[model samples]
Target: MYQTDNLKQKIKLFMIIFFPILITQVSLNLMTFFDTVMSGRAGAEDLAGVAIGSSLWVPVFTGINGILLAITPIIAQLLGAQEDKSIKQKVQQAMYLSVGLAIAILLLGLILLNPILNTMDLEYEVRHIAKFYLITLGVGIIPLFIFNTLRCFMDALGQTRMSMIIILIALPINLLFNYIFIFGKFGVPAFGGIGAGIATALTYWVISLLAIAILYKVAPFRDYQLFSSWVRPRVKEWLEQLKIGVPIGFAIFFETSIFAAVTLLMSAYSTNTIAAHQAAMNFSSLLYMIPLSVGMALTITVGFEVGAKRMQDAKVYGYIGISGGIFIALFNGIVLFAFNDYVAGLYNTDPDVIALTVQFIGFAIVYQLADAFGAPIQGALRGYKDVNMTLVIALVSYWVIGLPTGWILANYTSLEPFGYWVGIITGLSCGALALLARLIHIQKKYRNQIENSSAT
Candidate 1:
């Protein structure tokens, strides 16, 4: 394992892992950013449709993808323990699980998606765009799931720069496709917001193919023979991973679904309201990538430390990650506060849209610090494999506390859409505090166990 005793050494190793992951994360999110921007340019209806479609898609994607995410820490810990023999088999099993989950999600979408959209009071264009956007996006689901499994494997191995490079290659292709489809370049029909879906779906395939090639061709990766040495699907291994994955999946789902729920709620309001909300949200999500990357980095770093029985080193990584996340959020807040209008304008030029987006960004500013605080700790806890509490915390803090507060405030008072933002801020703050306390308890418990063992 890398040196963890020296603060500088730890920080150096952290950065080595962090920077590529940061670029990879931010670049991936930029796909959404481009989608929103390009769709917004197409028209308000286009933007709203894509936004609504995304609201539905994101939670499902992340929740299921979160299951695949377990491979990262699982492999990281295995690496730390120098247990390399089972690595290839574990990844193969994860691939099988990813395929199964993708099939399940697809079936669910077919059964439930249209009904859910139908229940929402959306504009005709918005509804049409949203429906087709999801359908088009669906074509890529299997590949995307496969790709993410590969990504988690690579990330766990700390081959993040390779992931970063693959995504960077995909980004421009996504952009080009989005333009061609959205604007009807060459022979393609104008798809508007649905084109963004087509673009994203195609991008998923591209990245997945690229990732596979890398695994096949790369030195250390090829040594694992990820493709040739496929392991048969075993229920026992699947259950073991699902044990780790399901809570992580649900915790991510709960948090993401809160935002989706809020967006769905906003459907009752004007299309302009939904557009403005989405614009602010897209920009905020872009900024969120910073702390989020920190959190992701922590998962690998701290997981390795904990797996190596270095409790203090794990704690140090957690502290550094959490502190750095909050500090970066503060810096993001300053940027948002100073240039809220400019950022809002990037999404749309409609005066009302820009104005409301600016207002929502204000709410975002208030919560940046809290979001930063919570996210990294969540990552840290995952490193410790204390995910059940993370799931409970997310459920209560987001659904029980946050969503309800937003609903009441939006309906019972004049806050409306802004009220939802307030609720998000409240939930994030609560989750942060709860997670911090949980991390402390887990750390102490592990430390005591280790100490007692040493004494004996």
Candidate 2:
């Protein structure tokens, strides 16, 4: 009866924590879906253009944005410690840090843009169009980064629901611009992929502005002097946060690069196969947002508990969040398995493309469940500031095993697209296995330490 009651209470707490995150993550992914559909309407090349650029850019920016996540643990710890003074400074410092990270990525973007596209060996029209899109989309990086910083700052304070409202506004605004610029529906001339880039850039600024406005109105800490800090930044605070954040950034880079590399390999197959992979990938990405959000909540919860010295409760919270993630992922996996045809059909109009998409969707459905198998463990590791292992795991997962296996199948054998998805499954499964082992090892060690300390 005690166990039963405990399980029921966890379900209630999980629902409260999970729903808002699910809504926000889903909203943000919806924008990406809308962008893909708009690009699809333009042509195969246009679809390929955004895919190529985003394969590189999305992970790059998202990884950089992870830097600002320092605020969550910082704020959670301070809030637990009841240090209202440090909380304000920490938030201000995080903004500065986020902006710095964004600017650095912008420079990297400029240098990396052409070389990355050039190496792809695309045709003249395709390269030219893709370059234009990459450069224009690169312009949006600063706002996107800054917005992510602000969003994380809010999320740390438990006001993450703000992001959902902002994206709700940004969605129609992005679609309207896409309609106008992609087709020249309004007086604007048709620019296809380039127009899509501009629409995306404009929406970035709009969302950032809306985020600022909402925060100023609602966040009680608006009085904090970000630009004119009462004192020079405590360098120690900045360094501590970066120490925690940079490894996380690289961890994300290594994991996401697996997808980028696979997509590059997928180019070996016919264009239809790539399109099919895209449909399934895009669909899987939407589902991934759920687990990702749960991961965030788990990380924050664990961090908060650590800050408060509630070690046992943190352990319980980790189990609850991860278990909730597994349950939700299983349900999502089932739905994707059941509805692959219908979901793939929504984006893919080509009969051949639709057929290929079904197979890719089969892989996607399984990946959704595997996501639970991996991401939550990574999140728990993050809560403990143990990220260096992920870097090594990434080396093995993406570069050593995944890439080579994929190449052998795509180039050296007949498995083709099926081989590509199989390689991803293999890499994720191995990575998940490693992460689970590490998580158990560390948590048990920590529990022993806690027990000894209390006994003393």
Candidate 3:
């Protein structure tokens, strides 16, 4: 939104947008971190159950949320292009699409939950907890979807701080709920890991209601009159958004589901192995929030510049964002490398679990730079609406190349669980290279188009 081309101003704007998003994302992931830590204290079985449930929930939820994420770039571009009149309707249509998707996912998840768990070679307790956890977690799907829709809307308008504040408010409430539920306080039966799911479901509803209240009562957002008029859901608009959204959705799904797949593969190992993997992954995910936030901010900044027909400015933003992300990742990797053992001990007291977790975090450290590199570039591509190729790249990189290599290495070699991490590192590095190339191509094409138009 800062119109000045000054480098200092650009960096300031990027930071202004990036920091709130960083907090928001960190807060969101912390909820999961709390769930893992609290459930782990309850029992190893509890921790593994929650981890498996999360593996199922994450891919499905993020994939669908990725579709709704299209709203950010769409609205950002609309704002940049000064197409304000169309914003309200697009938002309404997205809301409708979200509700419909939530209901379908909930119902389908219910039908498939038992079948999926049955297939996993899990302990009886682990399987039981995983099944019920997902079932309880399903209660929040609609609200979560709605909350994300509102969050994306707010974010596109450079109002990242609003969502940050709302989630900050939700964080303690979520922690409290987790404590009360997981510990069985106040006459509630101790449901262990399932309590975490209940707490999360309740927290989702809390955040959704808070977001709606903020939007209605807050200035500027209220001026949009988003809720003022009824816009009937039209198939045409749904398809239009989906055209942009589906690729983004599946691209995220493919990438995230690899982690989920690894979690699933770990199920056949000892309960300790599963627990260790989950803890390391949970910590790794917390670290990942940094680069991920950078990418989300890039989508907004780059989308706005591209929409304003300033391809060069968009390129500058991409460079700033990507470089900043990698630098932070290097710092994170160093810290994580130095303190991984201490970090691992935060999850559980069992020495074996801690040791395994520390080893896994080492692999996480190795991948940080590559992960930082790819994530924000994907955000930049979304800004250009160049998402379809990203989907293909993600599929090929993670599934075709990464997962297969991991499977062979884990099953056929001595590396065992650590082999999967090697594969993940390899995949992330490859994806980063491919994404960088694609971003370069898109930038050049647009620059040429602009030059020709100016010459004529």
Find the candidate with the highest lDDT and give its number.
3
- Between 1 and 2, whose lDDT is larger? 1
Report the C-alpha lDDT of model 3 over 353-448, residue by residue, as the tens digit.
999999888888987778888999999999999999999999999999899989999999999998998888889899999999999999999999
> Candidate 2 on 1-456: residue-level lDDT in tens?
001125467456555655676787887777677767677777767766666666777677667755666566667666655676776667667766777777887788778878887787565655666788767776777788778777776665656667777887888898898888877886898887777787888889999898878766664536544434445556777888888777777777777777877776666566667667877888888888887888777666666666666666667777877786788788888888889889878765878888888888888777667766688777777776677787678678867877677767766678776777777777777787888888787778778887899899
Model 2 segments more than 4 A misplaced = 1-11, 219-235
- Ranking of predictions according to TM-score: 3, 1, 2
lDDT of 3: 0.93
- Model 3, residue 119: what's the lDDT? 93
Candidate 3 to truth, TM = 0.99
Clashes of 2: 0
TM-score of each: 0.99, 0.92, 0.99
Whole-model alpha-carbon lDDT for candidate 2: 0.73
Q: Candidate 3, clashing residue pairs?
A: none
**Segments in model 1 whose C-alpha atoms lie over 4 Å from true places:** none
Look at candidate 2 and tell me the lDDT of residue 374.
80
Alpha-carbon shift of residue 37 in model 1 (angstroms): 0.9
